[model samples]
Target: MLLITGITGHTGGYFLKELINNKYEGAIRCIVRNTSNTSSIDNSRLNIEKVVGDLDDPEFINRIMVGVHTVMHIYNIHHSPMIVQAAIENKINRAILVHTTGIYSKFKYASEGYKIIEGKISELIKNPKCPTSITILRPTMIYGDLCDRNMSKFIKMVDKLRIMPVINGGRSLIQPVNARDLGVALFTVLMSQKETTGKVYDLSGEKPIKMIDVFKIITKELNLKTIYISVPLSIGVSLARILKILTLGKIDSIERVQRMGEDRSYSHNNATIDFGYNPMSFEKGIKIEVQEYLKKNRN
Candidate 1:
């Protein structure tokens, strides 16, 4: 049986779909806190057993991991090392950890923003009780269904402002991987237990697109007559800082704007080679996202 946590989330939902699509002959159990909410899947092969408990609860881990072969951990909350550690303690042989790429390059940013995600991962990996072979997949900006935030916000902002701002020298790059592709990569990793144990895969899109160009595409898709204005990074940072202070730094929107002005490009050659990861093109991903947005907002 395959046990999945955070089944309501983007990658988790997609992973469930991928599993069903592949016709895996196994019981799929979703450990969800809210048993009242049923998944949108209509497949007989999918059996969701909602284990009602929080990740912070110690006793819930053992109860959920019982008789589970593989555990796909996709918790939205960053901390809570106990969740994974408990799985390890329960002797789940194969575990797949879904981490964000933000954890590597800027460790400080990752640690502060992510809050013990990578640290917890390392802790679980080194623990003696952790006999479970683990595969870590860190992805960059993800876009597609179940994504009500991030890129969708950009599109909404453009639709609202009727004009988009592109930071000066908007050549900073981004690789927004489609959610389905990420799901596919996760299933591929789980299905194959070869040389991936104790390794990390950077699952990114096929190509990186300029941040400004991304806004342009979003604007065009919304059929909005918008003008792109380039703002200096210094000014943008100051504004972001002020807004952050104003918002008390709770999910600051300005911080996201500041990041767009900075370059964030990397090679996913390792993931491609290791897991046969084939992420969809950024263009196609954006197109699908746009369609989904339009459909959601349609009258």
Candidate 2:
């Protein structure tokens, strides 16, 4: 049996669909906190099962890990493995952890002082009897139709305002991988030979695109004429700090601006060489994603 966490999100949904489409005959279990809407989910693969429970609950971990041979950890949270300590104790092997690139790229404390998040996952992987033959996948700027958080928000904001926001001329490089491709990569890692254990793969697009060029893609996709306005990082950070204070860290326009300042360019050579993983071109993904958005919003 294979267990998938965060089965409702973009990467998880794509992984589920791909696994089902591939006619994977193994028992597939998804861990979700909410069970109120299981009617619409595809059950073509009768081996699929839904294990309901909160990610933080140890009982949920216990329920899903029973007789499970492999686990794909995509549920993003602070200290997620702590919840699944029972699985480690049970000695269930072949765990693939899907972590964020933020822990690698956007982490301020990593270079300056100590390795906090990634370091902890590494420590867990080192445990001899932990039953976690871990493969850590850190992906950069995952963008797709169901992706409403980062790049999608920028597209939506631009579409709504008929203007694009640029931070200091938007020269920072970005490597935005499609969510579907990310899903495929995860599935690949999960299903690969046991030799892939203890490997760290940095998944990224074929090439990095400039932040300004990303705005151009959104403009062309939406067929909207918009001018880019440059805002300094200092100004953006100051405003975001104020908004965080005013909205109690809920309003996030300022944080987006801060993230736009990072250089997210990454090399895909290691990922390709290790697991034969190659992400689709950004140009190709943009068209498909735009169509999906149009289809969803039209109804």
lDDT against the true structure, each candidate: 0.74, 0.74
Instruction: Measure candidate 2: CA RMSD.
Output: 2.7
> Per-residue alpha-carbon lDDT of model 1 for 1-299, expressed as tens digits?
78877777777778877877887777777766655345454443566566667777678777888899888887663533665677678887887888777754443554375546666667777866567877877888888753746788788778788555667757888887888898898888888778688788888889888887888888778788877778888788788888889888874655566576666766789887886888887777778888888887875
lDDT of 1: 0.74
TM-score of 1: 0.89
- lDDT score, candidate 1, position 248: 87
What shift in Å separates residue 3 of candidate 2 from its native position after superposition? 1.4
Which segments of model 1 are wrong by more than 4 Å? 41-44, 77-80, 105-107, 111-116, 127-130, 245-251
Model 2 lDDT tens row, 1-299 = 88877777777777777776777788878776665345424555448787777767676577668888877878774545653465576677777777766655564543322246556656666766676667778778888774646677766776778655588788899898888888888877877856478787878887999888888887788788988998888887888888888998788566466777888888878779878997888888877877777677766
